[model samples]
Target chain A: MNGSIADPKAVRRTILRNLRSALLELGSATKAELSDRLGVSFPTVSKFLGQMEKAGELLPVQLDDSSGGRRANRYSYNPEVMLGLALFLERTETSYIVFNCAGEVKDQGHAASVLTADITDFDALIAALVNKHPQISAVSVGVPAAVNNGRLIYIPEYEQFHDLDLKAHCEQRFQLPTVIENDMNAAVYGYYMARHQRSELQPSLVYLYFGQNGPGSGIMLDGNIMRGSSFFSGEVSFVPLYDQYNFGEAMRASHPHPRFPDGDLSVDAVARLIAVFAAVLNPHGVILSRHEANEGLLAQLEAASQAYIPREHLPAFILSDWEQDYLYGLQGLSLDLMLSREAGGN
Target chain B: MNGSIADPKAVRRTILRNLRSALLELGSATKAELSDRLGVSFPTVSKFLGQMEKAGELLPVQLDDSSGGRRANRYSYNPEVMLGLALFLERTETSYIVFNCAGEVKDQGHAASVLTADITDFDALIAALVNKHPQISAVSVGVPAAVNNGRLIYIPEYEQFHDLDLKAHCEQRFQLPTVIENDMNAAVYGYYMARHQRSELQPSLVYLYFGQNGPGSGIMLDGNIMRGSSFFSGEVSFVPLYDQYNFGEAMRASHPHPRFPDGDLSVDAVARLIAVFAAVLNPHGVILSRHEANEGLLAQLEAASQAYIPREHLPAFILSDWEQDYLYGLQGLSLDLMLSREAGGN
Candidate 1:
């Protein structure tokens, strides 16, 4: 068999890719540790690390402690490679967070609602942000609306933004790639990606997000977000909860019931939703986000499962920390955009 | 440029592959029709058709009469090229049907029951069928049970079949590849494939099968059947109807209330389920089988959608022909298995 030498450019790219992955996973690493972890020789690692540093891909942080010999410099990923603006539009507030390539928050601010009453304020905000940070690679917006192909299909209190085509509008104005997703769908995507990094998540799960607006689902099949035929999937807010139980009254402000039905996260509603999820889709697990999930709700869901589903067929119910998962989702998408640019031989 | 000659073996395989696909789609065709459709020489088509005919892969069914020229022989794909015993286990009676590579029904019969009580009888039945047809390709069984890894994880009526290891048992007994699927899962798969052939179905839809045993859901995403986390995605019978109503009573024969909650499909149980499906998944359409679905039910569902979901967010409700969807599903699976064998370079 003839021994062939590997391509030097390919080898260098592989080394860079491995180093970047390790940095992302570990947050920070020293040259010696990276060499040991990547199974590359110290001199070769040092050579590539020097080149990467010159290329502005790695940044030197503090030096690592050494026993006696000279200390090695600890390096963190150079997040300034690309910038992304993540806009999380809720019912009453539109939160904007800017993150560099490293998925670290660099800048953030909160503003008045931009989508419910009108999209004029949102248009102004984007124009100002684009002028402020012309270096941003992409813009991602997550809104509390039923989105289908970048158009707002429904948002009870925010009918003015219907058929806005905000994604197209943003792209046309900014000249940078922009993505607009339903807030709950984005959250579900972020939750799936986060749980998958730990390697404990199943290939399929549904994340139920209940916010000030209402309940919605983010369905992940094989760890990817599922947008139905028209991208109208996961509108859980409209899920009819027992026609006689005044579930609709919660939606109507006039005949207001407990806000639990309107994202209160109480007992019967959660239990019934879990049962329906189990019986309908049988996902490995269900993740509840931004809900008042407590031990009482968990107990009721489990006890009810015993009556409806078999002992073995019950799905695990998980309560997510009330963090801005939509921001994480936006950052993830921004990273994908940056990677696609590289894949296209940028 | 060097002109490459097609290998006769690959060419003949391609011809056979195309012919098989056409037969599955069109049901039957003549040699002249196939030649014209496939853009092959008439002589070549005749040569290969002759070989396939001799090998029982196809059969001469009827004659295509001509005005002046000699009458041509119309050939239909032989329904016994590769036989598959498809068993659809219901509550009381187990229906069996056999199909060929073209998914045409060959032979069928059913015993009193299978997998509900004991596997001893099922084992004997399988053994008898094996003896009856040694040329059978595979055996596909669809059981009314929530299956996890080919084992019955949940079955309300037949708790005895829980953890039965049914697929392994059939494989060991028949010495052939076997597949055991949730009854509703297969029905959904079958329904999806059948509708997709006509190119009129949606990319995402759910088939609700209400059998005598209970209700089950078959979810299809992008024309593919989705078996959630542990193959337990579609156990719709467990869906809670109301916060206070006894929806589980219908499943428990002893605690039977007035068949349905309130016996009025307009408000509580049925409408809510449809509304929930529309809100949560937003599938393009919903197919209802084995139910007393009528125009009144449709009117009520539309009215409820107006109350819960947006006008544009409603899914078209379809009533399935109450024949046997599970049988169609089993036939589809068996056909796939046979084609896979051929694709593996058999």
Candidate 2:
């Protein structure tokens, strides 16, 4: 029985939710184990498990060792029972990944850049992917813009996609749960989740990127993405780090490419930004892409940062693949939607 | 019966916790109202209420009007059942407030500056307060330093208080639960709580203060204090906002007093700091003490900040009483401890 002793439908929802979470955590569990863990009766667990199995949400993976009687069936969540579609719309290309509930990628591809095209192109691309993967249960898209609850509220040059309720549009068209996240937000979440150990531990971190879209950051404080009051938490482009120029203008003046610039001006700006993070946030780590933060630049940054703040206060500088982290983040969001949907018995 | 069908103690704890929160929300409620809200059996609620009433933790407020049935008795949580001692150690003086669970100030006073004096002096002040208020159940101390889990890990001028486990020491000495918080954290929380409407709505804000010691800030995001990884989230004095000087250095160079300076340099620096918050945190409000901000200075800051970031992204600048907010925040913390203790039936 649900602990609250609420309405029956609400009780069932709570029981199924707990059972699903336990199954995910345990990998596989016999009806008795789930019953013991959830404090639900054995018959209650058995009924839900039977219903879920009939709905193709669970599978009998193995048999529990018999003590003195018949062996009990150990059931596991069907990893491929549902699929998720993850996509990122970048400056020049649109990349996507189709993954299962277990986060295993089944297909990956690229399409034309949606920023310069119409919303229909983006819709058609998703439709194609959905048709190919008929089991797709959720969709998550990442865009380099300030997103407010799935609406592209601020997109400087991407006017074609500006003010679009991407989540609502996609959900309506595909009849699936959809999430739209800011690019940097997704990247930071992906980076945070990529490390299995760190995923369990909430680590405050800042992921900085000088992308084709411009300089931006993703902030994760205590394991949560800090989407600021106006959903502009990671828009570091306008941060005035100098007397005459902002971060974006200074970066553009120092270098043409997204790679780390060796110029003193650019170096000072990056070091100052890191120092600001150290003083204000004091995060556990400051993550940067390997393409933008080599050993030599990292060394220079560490030394330069000490001039502004104490060395002990600085966070660890990490190098990661931004592309991989972004896709992983999108996949993670999609998987969450699928799990909640399943728990809701939708 | 307990709904969990497991540990009766745990179930009782949950029900009591829920009941306490509901009563606090509803102000006063009848036994049947609590039983229906908690989804616990009427007998269970009746038993707990009876025990709590006998313990003096609850009071029979009045009787509800009969609706062709028995007049139900409305019970309320006893506001004076426990008291909380809240104190802040400042450069010039130590201010304290004794408040009850209902947030009514029972007493408030100030003592000699604890920074220059010995920790014994601080303890004596608390002892005196506790002696007078025998019902004091929790203690909360706010200090101007980085606090990691109630330990004063960073105290620049006050070396005597450095590395002191204030919470543990106080709890042991007074035989009451204690909490130690950073001064700015308390101030921001107090400011956040002072506005009852905002308390219900989570608004991201930064409370900046330039005091006798130095400049510090408290950050509130979605209604929770942003205590960074190292418990150094609001230590913004070292932020290298300018090439030659950090925020503190620049401010000191521009002004002698901890007030809004008329110099253009200070104005620019303040504007830039606001711009940084705009581009990064984008908080709903940037709070400042009335002593440190005025109409003329605020206008200059608004104009100067436009050079860095767009006007649309700027947060509303708010002026509040720093001292009041700090004390209120400490009281809020102590009240939380008291509430949890009452719910635990301890």
Candidate 3:
């Protein structure tokens, strides 16, 4: 290790990195506590904190009383220093969200349902985001399609987005590196990160997100998104659920006699479908978002599913708090990118 | 670096490790090739090769012909230097396999009609394996149950093996480090590793192993097993296919006014059930196998499945050629362990 390579600039960067991580994990910490954690002398920690404060990276916050001593000033990372831009696109609408370093939604904007095939609206969406959030450092867009090597390879259901150079376009427009991922993958990551933060659960997770037409599944193995070969591994909608019997005929047959003509396969039908699918995948849990999920219908479907499977042993199912799901995913992607960059630097 | 601390013992281990990986990937190499690949001097490669040959770890193979000069003698790692013991346990039978360093099966043995719930039989299975292959170095067992952190946490349909201390029992009997994994996990790993070796197509794999009563699914995401929280993911069989519709009712509804009056659901009915299930999961491919997946039955099942799914764009469906999918999984586990160990050492 060359002494010159460990220059003041490099040392300062390392100190900042350590402080950022500590703040991210602990929310806030005192200079003394950070010094002990970083194994740096108290004076060194104080000096770095001073420099970071001057650089507008850290903000001083009032601290609680220390044991029998005067209260020391605590420091927290400035949320506005860097922002993450997240774009979530579906069949009906395009949503853009800005999240701060602490995974909090700083701002959000949405555009009316735009057909993905007519990507003319995509440019407008990006333009709106850049204009709204000038401090955005990186952007991650979620598409209802398959992405391979950072390229949108296929969106069979949403054919318009297929073969689109969303990554290059976004990067050039925003002047920031961009990543485009499968919406299901993003949702899964978002759900997993949220669950992990809230509970003492396992590191690995499988999430099933139900949409209008079909359900999408995302798997996290060993604490990382397991993007299978060609990045189409988690396309669970294509997973076969029923044998060759006509779905239409089965639905009709399930309808009661003519006197009690069965109502349309309401939200309940979809929930039953989800429950069945969940039974098959046996994931950690299934997450239903109100944005797309028919909660009342799923409850009825779940009851039907129990009757069909006759097995009490099944993974838990929950409805995602929609207001937070997409935003949470966006924040998680930002953190993932930051962590990867930091790890690479190390 | 202290010269004495990095003596022949350390040097020899490193050289052997590098040589093992090179051989695993490239099969064989000349001393000069090994020297260049290992980034060691030619003299060091020669010395290490000589020592390895003396220790029976390296074997001199046919020479590689040069353009005009003397041919170069190529050395290969001895596959017998390390052995992997693989156990595949089913409801009624247990298959034991010993694999060489290169993942080729050396020998196989079997025990019949042993119930996993019966402790004596389980112990006898382990005893039989130890008695048969005393030279086995490491053991990997595949149980038809869900495993969480090496513990059989849930077996779903398997009433007997739920929450059993399988790893502990195996370790106690064998007095060797052992890995106990769910049968589906092993199947997925086996399929992934086998395809990687045999084909250039990097398809996302979803392996469905049809047992006597039902089927078990193993999902591979990005060439890795999608183990969920509690290692209970991929239990696709339990996914509900019909709501309040029994197998007989589902069949009768699909084929109204059937020629036969018998209430028994035909194998075709089961095939239909499978097809419907497959439609929901939409895997890149579906592999049907069992402890007894013979060629004749496999062909019939494949044909029937094709007829069941109406979608022309369905994923490829095939039958596993290997009789012992669990053995292949064991081989994969051993290979993974070896690769991880080498990675850690480096």
Candidate 4:
């Protein structure tokens, strides 16, 4: 681009942006690969690579086999270049973690949450984390409710959180870009990214979080979170059972005794929900997250699915990791924000 | 581009392709708009417009108002440039229609189909249509089955259609590009395009077809069909009912009568599913197609949805057009193949 010489500063910025994107996409790239991929001269790439390396934005890794000629160096994005703070809010407690650009945990904290929960102590915790790691560039949060463009529209468990705009609060307090997502959406996104690393796992998946109160699902089609018009697409708790009794009916005091025992596991309602997923979305994998999906429950679910779906067409069922999935999702959101800031420059 | 002194043929091809694309995207464009959109010189755009008009691929239209001063000519895609042959195969009979690029009907045909009915007479019908309209560029077929990469993988109601590789057969016999889509899939796609044009309908939608033997659904998330792995998504007949009996169980002769009359409607099951859709996917609208979705049925569905979903959160319920929605879907598919060929060129 500089060869045309229209504007030196603009071309330099473009070159740097392209270089960063190339390295991040490929995980690591040789100087020749960077030049070929970016349509830039090798010398310009080398000059920028050297500059970025000195600025602590890029790192050089020597190849394992170079044929003993001039040593070939592969460049990688510096994992520690920036930190992302993630907060997951539950009814009783709020948990937080700091992760680097590569999603590796650097620090962690927690504070109790209640109906009276406010940003006072939360602000203190964020301030402490930022004081320890001044490089934090973004914050991501997950809440148990319906969120639409950063505002909490509904939180049955915590009425105080309703209509709250946590994104603005975090941005103002931490002086960083912020994002708030539905807890179910975050967990499923995390699960998909983790499972997708395996070549055999299909890219499309649905994560059903069978909870104590009801069920909620998160959908990933073609590796993108399927955020609906209101950004509240995955609120599955409201799904009715085959009868007038919806999943939420289980929580009602006057609800009749369950036809199937064992809670969310091995329940007829859960199996019917799974059947709906199998027939409707036909995701490659349907993960039952946040529940003790034991082998017995798996057998019953398999049997129920067989009765409805063709045996040959049943999606693979797996129990998801209960604890780390949300954190993984938060990290994924953090990385997205950090990288998108460069592409969008805001 | 031609000013760069590049090969004139490649430049001409590029110019024609860009002009056609701009007109299609904008519905209509003047020479100035073409120059601005394509980043081509006005003279170059005007020259290509003249050439394309001569070739009958472009048509010039006068604006509604000219005011009698240097009237500008608006160019539109020649709707009659090529024809798209669409065949909708059903249980008792097969119907065919030929549409132009603008999805206007040009010709139509039909043939009877039975258990032993093969494509022998259907092939003759197709050949006759092609013989009459040699400009036909492609063929699209809709079948009631689970399709995977142009192969019919399952059709429990019609076993003969199973594993049928209709795309290759049509491609070889007609010498035209061919596409085979699920019938329900096409209907919802057509429904979306129809409603999408009105500006009042929500873009994301789910179309439920409660047929006599089975029920199936089609989903449109973010304006794209949600074709799951194996192209088998939206086979809603396989969804498990809340009771021991699933939807497919109705096919089993030994199975007892349905617990609720009217088949999944005016029943808790219908309400439950509506609530599920209301909360889970949060689509803008839900259209009940090909069913006796009368006022009573609508009342039941609305009440069911309202029980779990907040009144404000429910999607609009529409009694979809049964007869022409599928044809509209076929037209949409035909137009897509026609436009995509110009864009993808393969």
**What's the i-RMS of each model?**
11.7, 6.1, 9.5, 7.8
Instruction: Give the range where candidate 4 chain A is weakest over 10 consecutive residues by summed lDDT.
Output: A1-10
| Local lDDT at A91 for model 2 | 81
TM-scores for chain B, listed for all candidates: 0.73, 0.84, 0.67, 0.79
**Residue pairs clashing, model 2:** none
Cα RMSD to the true fold for all candidates:
9.0, 4.8, 7.1, 5.8
In model 2, which regions exceed 4 Å deviation? A1-55, A58-60, A63-76, A197-199, A255-263, A343-346, B1-54, B58-60, B63-76, B114-117, B197-199, B255-264, B343-346
lDDT ranking from best candidate downward: 2, 4, 1, 3
User: Model 4: clashing residue pairs?
Assistant: A239-B276, A242-B269, A243-B268, A244-B268
Per DockQ, the best of the predicted structures is 2
> What interface root-mean-square deviation (Å) does model 2 yield?
6.1
Q: Name the docking class for model 2.
A: acceptable
Give one digit per residue, the lDDT tens place, for model 2 in A10-102: 566667767776787678999988887778889889988888888878875688889899999999988887888998888889989998877
lDDT tens digits by residue: candidate 4, A1-346: 1222124465566677667756776788889887766667788789988877877787757673576687678889887777788988887788889888766788887778633576676677778888888888888988887777687877886666779888887777667888888887788788876655422444777887767666677888777777665655666656555444555464343344454444442365566666676666777877775366777777788886676677666778877785678788888888767754442232
Query: What local lDDT does model 3 show for residue A286?
Result: 58
Compare candidates 1 and 4 on DockQ and give the better one.
4
- The DockQ for candidate 2, computed on C-alphas, is 0.47
Of the two candidates 3 and 4, the one with more favorable DockQ, higher being better, is: 4
What is the clash count for each candidate, in the order shown? 3, 0, 31, 4
TM-score-wise, the better of 3 and 4 is 4
Candidate 1 residue pairs in backbone clash: A260-A264, A281-B233, A282-B233
Taking all chains together, the TM-score of candidate 3 against the true structure is 0.72
